[model samples]
Target: MNRERIIAIVAQARAGQATDEELQELADALDRDADGSVTSAMEESLQQGRQQIALPGREKADRMLADILETGQVLEDPGEEAETPAVIAPLKPGWKRYGRAVAAAAAILLLAGATYFLLRQSPRPEEAPVAGTNPLAPAAEGLPAGKKAVLTLANGATVMLDEQHNDTITRQGNTSIVKKEDGRLAYQPGNAAATGLALRNKVSTPRGGQYQVDLADGSRVWLNAASSLLFPVDFSGHERVVELDGEAYFEVAPDNSRPFMVKAGQTTVQVLGTHFSVSAYSDETLQKTTLLEGKIKVLAGNTGYQLQPGQQVVFDKIRAGSKLVPQANTEEAVAWKNGYFQFSGADATVLLREISRWYNIEVVFNGIPAGYELSGKIDRSIRLSSIVTALREGGVHCTLEDNRLIVNK
Candidate 1:
């Protein structure tokens, strides 16, 4: 608070009649302005002591009254020639010392009190703002709440049903792809075409989750939460393939006739209809590919590696040795397809980044964490704060500072 208000509060406190509301207001003000541990009541009590004593310090007037208690020691106790010490230290040095000392003492008390007050409050660190700019606001404004992705048939026909709908959707072609009311999308080969046609089948879901139909090439794909998969309705010409983002698991129908390919980020995987998982979030630094039941080739530029079952390749963009690592409990990698957040010793930044996408919120780091790792399996439908609280309970502390999630180091 300003100087006048502080003085008035101190006066009221000294009289032992400060109201509760006034005390609370004073506490809030001190907390906000003083940057110290002292609460309003404690500070008020200290101030009250200062007000009660009136020892002259800064000379308000030229002639000030000083208390003198002189005992009759000498016979003629200085009737005219008495030269005792002119200034006496008061029991309480309210005005006896210069105002600077009082102000300094008050400032010290404020700092000490604030430190104690905050330590007793909680372990939560203060949140801070993010640097640079916010990219999500403009992006949300430019894009629709739900976007549309379609599949174009070789015969120049398109099917649209990426968003909410009450009826079935169909694409006209030799092989007609249909999205049923139950949300199960499938493709059927039509007798109209003597030869199979090249079909681009696209399957997309909204914020929660969705699934897709790859048709009778026998390849079945399950798109995970907040994810999409783009593939051909039927394996044609060169290969059977699909593109993905967020997370998706594939059970490729063993097609000896064609090589199934999954494109994730800059990495490409070629497989002949085997089960596999790919997570290539554009915002993530690592593009991960895990082979479940068949052999696959992971290619990045000219560098290609053949991956056996139970092997995984992690393409690390920010470091050397973008080496391939052995797969962990494969269940964890494909847990999203089963509607779970399977974390394996992920750091705070990694966990929050995944949460930000699923919850559709922006993440900004406030400070460095203590370098703690998190591992667990949780349902993605849980509340955001609930997840945060759980992580805090597990020793990784965080707080919402400004619009960002600030982790404590």
Candidate 2:
């Protein structure tokens, strides 16, 4: 809101003629003001009673804000101890019947002024986070992660792949490891007998980063942030095998002669040629293998579960037990690859863990949050404040401090 608009709203509020929407806007503006608390000037003016007149313009509002910085910031207002409560007019008929209440106009002036001030001072969200830069809030400092990863060569040499180089990154055995134009790493396999075969090269993404790779067999893998995949440059054995430490989505190349196997923790996922996703984070108790196309089998100890398309296998890491969810939400499972965090009644612990990885921040729970489960989908590029604000709406109180997210009751 502009200066003139705010002043107009305050005039209407003092006259008890402001519309509900206008008053609500003022209230919202005030809540975003300098800590939203009672200012020393307002307190003193209230005690004087002689100063009970409403602030006439932006200049008075400006003076009131100057007095607040000395006492520090707090969310609570001093209420009766501050300036006289701005009288609120009775709501329009049928408003109360809708079960929504209107706030008193006394707070409208403060809100409108503060809201206008903040909107003018702060950079809009669209200007905040640049590509490959940390887009943290004022309380924190850290760039949000991007599509990046580290490639561990078979000879123990590590190469940092920040973006598609459109050139050869390295050569392992007869396979030419190159970064394609689409930001994907590809292994072009030659005759292994002539160039020699490298055992295994590992690709891993740091927290807040992700990467994709195309194996020699035409298989594709999308590694999520804080995840790793280990595979040979070229597969020639009876079966193609890869080891995973975190989460990844795989589109396996069909080779009926050789089975494609993924070893995630103690459980092994075996597939011929299929589209599936695996979540095996060390912090999580269960390793999930959800299939989106074809069929796959999850094997742990003597227990094994076959998953059809749209099914998921939940393997408990501790119990080594496995179960099949016959009809799974494959879209949610692969949402990360498409750049979204999709949740349908997810636990706070699970949702926040994924958030922590992407934001490269810390999460410390002072007490369990209010909502045990929430269903939503958010773009990965949004700032941390957007997520925290959503949580607050779900009755979860949290504070984003320096490099840490403190979740309260």
Give the alpha carbon lDDT tens digit for every residue of 278-383 in model 2. Answer: 9999989888889999988888656888888999888787887878888887888988887667665476678778889988888998877543554434456556
lDDT, candidate 1, 1-409, per-residue tens:
5656765764554444566466555544544443333333344544455556633331111011010001101111112211111110011212223222222222222222110000111234533434563322332321112233454544566555565363435544555566656655667666554245555655655443346554656677776546667666655566766788767788887867788888877789998868888887766788788888988899854468898888888887666235677754576677666545555446657767766656555566657564444444444544455455444443444554333445655
TM-score of 1: 0.56
Total backbone clashes of candidate 1, pairs 3 or more residues apart or in separate chains: 14
Full-model lDDT, candidate 2:
0.66
Q: Estimate each model's TM-score.
A: 0.56, 0.66
Leading candidate by TM-score:
2
